[model samples]
Target: MTQYQPIAAAAAATEWWRGAVIYQIYPRSFADSNGDGIGDLPGITARLDHVASLGVDAIWLSPFFTSPMKDFGYDIADYCDVDPIFGTLTDFDRLLDRAHALGLKVIIDQVYSHTSDRHAWFQESRSSRGNAKADWYVWADPKPDGSPPSNWQSVFHGPSWTWDGRRGQYYLHNFLPSQPDLNIHNPDVQEAILDTARFWLDRGVDGFRLDAINFSMHDPSLRDNPPVAPGAGPRRRPFDYQHHYYNQSHPDIPTFLARIRRLLDSHGGRFTVAEVGGEQADREMKLFTEGFDRLNSAYGFNFLYADALSPELVRHTIDLWPGAPGEGWPSWAFSNHDAPRHVSRWAAPAERKACAALSMLLLMALRGNVFLYQGEELGLPQADVPFELLQDPEAIANWPNTHGRDGARTPIPWAADAPHAGFSPARPWLPVDPEHVPLAVDRQEEDPDSTLNLTRRLVALRRREEALRCGIIRPLDLAAPLLAFERGDGPDRLLCLFNLGRAPADWRLPEGWTVIEAVGGEATGGSVPPLAGLIARRSA
Candidate 1:
């Protein structure tokens, strides 16, 4: 008998992301197969079993395309080819082949918003005014005073345009100057991006995790964004002090998304998930994933870049879309390549590991697709990377304010005692923290109650429970500082309670509720006289 029994069951499968968890592996830090101190495709291939064992539905590999490593592989020189630093096309095929064999769906990052200045298309576009690809990228003429097209600001700081003397025009770059934004308004440009998607689809990729999809289409008129008054907290950067009306979140983006969705639909059930960020993410996430005709799902930076993790905050995030209709789904990720590790950001040393483990349980209990970063299961805290060893351009450019992304991009420690923590025999690209040495996979593998075990069990538990997967969420009114909710599938209901405070809190349930998974403390009946936090299953 096959694991998938019927064709129709597979075709109409709610298993697309039904309580499914995705593991995000930053390629450069995952594993170094050739010991060049940098990770390669083969390195990831060598570790598919580790990922499969974690009970995740899929694995999302970050950018490995050819580039100058200016913004680490986010600046793509070639969209269809793998970078030499990460091995060859053959290596990626082998990795994908192996991952599929282990029952893991492979999803690769698609950076369609921008391309590196060194890309052939951009090179040709900049060469002349009447070139075949002159309109392939966002090229604009200078204003009356010779300033950029608009006052748009780059995410990396300073202005969003850089002068290109060759073309006698300014290029719009939402990120670094080298990362010129693509012209999505042009039909040929959209076709080229779709063709790039097809290249990977032809290689048997399960789906695509679109990087900054909202950034693909910008305001064609180049309208200036109005200044925003400082709201709650002190404004960190000038970029945050604007409504960002012009630079991104254009009305025409949904049409482009529908076009992309049509292409993916041609491949028979291939999924598309977008990464929506910036000030308007809350609004854009809904717009980008409004209908099934557009993106299958979209995740925002709501919880990822947060400094504090409270029950109320988590509840508010889930309540953002009470009952999302049509094809739009929400994917939640607490940690990723960007931002500091959640362990260090949310908790202290003594309780950080336990709190991190509990977070996994909470994430699994949530009513959305969950994305787990590679080292998150092992409770890996953000490591320290000195300025001398930092390879991240963002960190180097905005050193004092941003703190760079290198610390979170360090090598994944497979063995505590191995040379370079079993990531590489030679010195890794980003140094692994000495404190992270003991928290390696090998050490946690044998321990049943370790964070690794908790991740595996929680994922498995979520998979088994129907109410926990594709059910409707009902927020329960519990005491203060405690987040409680009920996930119900008709007759079955699961009551989830989380004590956000440090002290023990009593959980008063209305009726019959059985404690299923307890995080820290105990629970009894529908009410626990002294309940810390727990996940309880109930029947109507």
Candidate 2:
């Protein structure tokens, strides 16, 4: 085992997350300590050493809350306890202790947008119209014709409103019918959510990744969403047919965020990042993180759900947040539990390795906090999950048309030779991608040129260079297939360039710049090799 020192111990206690690299761990697929074939908190604790070895500042865990697993763990049955599938609260404490001991911060997902229909609050809310919790969820009487309140559509398809016979009214569910949207507009509901945050903070969690936070508060009027503009592309599901204005991104969400921030401030050094995605994500992300009173950071689907990683796309997204006064900080992620792997999405068969390396270099060079998905360091491609074994609700509901998210949520391959790729003692929950076996961690640890090792080096470089951390990004005017930028902070300055194209491209270096680090390909003779990335600094 490699000896590790906690990086947080040496850094400023507050704002440590600024420009930090956070590794996202999907607990259910990361590791399974018990032979039950499902990952538990103890499994995560046992793997803290591997996470620490990557030199990440913190780990953002997907939800492990008590749930009925309808939308996996997103449909929370209880706010304060871990599901039996993920172990008890004691198991979570152990994971936290082990993480902090290794110098890694632990940030868990806080899904305040909705809860499992099985949740006590929802149960009580649906029991009777006059019940104490009746208003805790978004429930409304049907329109005069007994149809849904508006043209709102659920993310999983069909109407967002589900008629509940128990309450003689319709209940709102932005996702699956079983995952009812919480009425955060209700003060009592807000208080209950804040108390849940207090529970985790009191247990020593470093911060929270607010899941689908923009959906926390909906338009109280229940107005219909306007139809999308013509040529908006084919609508795969009913959810994509409208502008989604009245259904989400309500104007009052920031006020609720301020409350969450106030609660976090009381805990000291606690961080909060909101997950904001939609057609109006850029606008809402800014609103949610506009000032110190709101979230610390926000990330959208600019790159995560993108089909291509183009230079123009990179420039456009980075331009959204320039670290200006009153603008909240931004975070960037190329892949996550909910999206397809970038390696498979962006790279051709021959260029997967190069593209993976280039992606990491670009992620670190960008002017914001960065997130690395669990198996991304290993260059894992999207798994091929057949229809019969598919588990995602949205995917199953819109089969054949939607690729689904299960391909990206497969278990991490720990050993190339071990059964189930060393993710569990028995068969894993999701089948391992056969292609990922060769890219397993045990195999890559010995290969100097492997993506795993390269990722570690890039992470370390980001930590060592102040210019790459909290620096201003100045994008250079370049042609398609090539993205160039300069990051500068104080006396430190660095030039970063990437050849996003498959064929080699060349560019003359400006005066005083010399290559400091080159990987995946070369930056020799003022030329960039295919899928190459180079970082340069002014010559002394």
Clashing pairs in 1: none
lDDT of 1 by residue, 303-402 (tens): 8988878877886787676653443567898899998998888877877776776678778877768899989999999898888887777787777767
- Candidates in order have lDDT scores of 0.83, 0.89
List ranges where model 1 is wrong by over 4 Å.
1-15, 231-234, 508-511, 524-532
Cα shift from native, residue 114, model 1 (Å): 0.5
The Cα error of candidate 2 at residue 430, in Å, is 0.7
What's model 1's lDDT at 134?
95
lDDT value, candidate 2, whole model:
0.89
All-Cα superposition RMSD per candidate: 4.3, 4.7
lDDT of 2 by residue, 1-540 (tens): 211111232342358888899999999999999888888899999988989999999999999999999989999999999999999999999899999999999999999999999999999999999999989999988999999888899999799999999988999999999999999999999999999999999999999999999888889999899998868777899988888888888888999999999999899998999998988899988999986799999977899988989999999987787666677888999999999999889988677888889999999898878999999999998999999889998899999999799999999999999999999989888899899899999999999999999999999999998778776787788997889988874346899999888777878778887878777666768777888889999888
Each candidate structure's TM-score, on Cα atoms with residue i matched to residue i, is 0.94, 0.97
